[model samples]
Target: MGEPLATKHDVFQAIADPTRRKLLKLLAEEEMPVTVISGHFPMSRTAVSKHLRILSEAGLVRERRVGRENRFRLDPQPLQEIKQWYAYFERFWENKMAALQYLVESDEPVKPEQ
Candidate 1:
């Protein structure tokens, strides 16, 4: 099995914060300049910039300078790692839910055919 990801730049860490997650959602819709991205949140531009920096470090977003306009866009490739990691546990949840369903159905009395 692959080892767990444990680092500041891990995609999981990048998305852990609500602000960062919102930033990713915004960028996913369309690429935008840092100014526009910072506008979406109520926080100061500097705070948004910090969140962007973390997302950049995690490889979830890419930045480029276009004639003084620093634009950001979602990369999305890194998020696959996070999804794959969670899929393992999702199976466990599914099995538990299936068992609970069986118990509930069993508790209901059966009706005879007319």
Candidate 2:
């Protein structure tokens, strides 16, 4: 393994709110200013800011103040923990499928159609 994944605090904080998840999806495409993020939600800028703050604390989003605007971007590395966890299930399912295939093939009779 490379480095340890993000702590529970990070993952929980990142996924605590639906707004944050939406923000993450948007940021995943490209970085945008606070205004752009607020445009997508019905909440106020302050509410969005709070969501962003939570995401930042979770190490999922990075914010930089450029002049008078705050630009927010996604930090995807933290999500690798989730991916790794899911990959474990993927392998388990794959092995089960292979075993099932072997069993089915082994039980098939090699009889010609008569």
Candidate 3:
């Protein structure tokens, strides 16, 4: 078995930019043309296109050509890997939160303020 091919555009890199993340949210509900997607951001359509390219390379977004127009939609499958990666750390935070709750709800009642 050979190692996986190295690609600069991974899920992390794809979503690293705020603009790309917004693009994902916009496409989450429905697929839209590149021109429409570009409207949501302050940047130029060409800049939006660049973000879309990164997203497509990372497997986070899928693009389909409808005649002369290109439609983009969220794939979401790649995001599962990111969710799973962060899930491992959730337990630590949960534990800390539980401990804080216990301290706040201790049996010893708080003294009346003087």
lDDT of 3 by residue, 11-87 (tens): 88888898889989999999999999998888899999999988888888888999999999988877876899899
Query: lDDT (CA) for every model shown?
Result: 0.83, 0.79, 0.83
RMSD of each: 7.1, 7.8, 6.2
Clashing pairs in 1: none
- Identify the leading candidate in terms of TM-score: 1
Model 1 per-residue lDDT tens digits across residues 1-114: 453333358787788899999999999999899899999999999999999988998888889999999999988878889889999998986786575543334656543323
Q: Alpha carbon lDDT of residue 75, candidate 1? A: 89
At residue 19, what lDDT does model 2 achieve? Answer: 82
Write one digit per residue (lDDT tens) for candidate 2, span 6-113.
Answer: 333566557867888899999999888999899999989899988888777777888899999999999887787678888999887678657554333466664442
Q: What's the lDDT for residue 57 in model 2?
A: 72
True-structure lDDT of candidate 3: 0.83
Mark the 10 consecutive residues where model 1 has the least summed lDDT: 104-113
Write down the lDDT that model 2 would get: 0.79
Error of 3 at 12 (Å): 1.3
Which residue ranges in model 2 land beyond 4 Å of their true spot? 1-8, 98-114
- lDDT score for residue 86 of model 2: 82
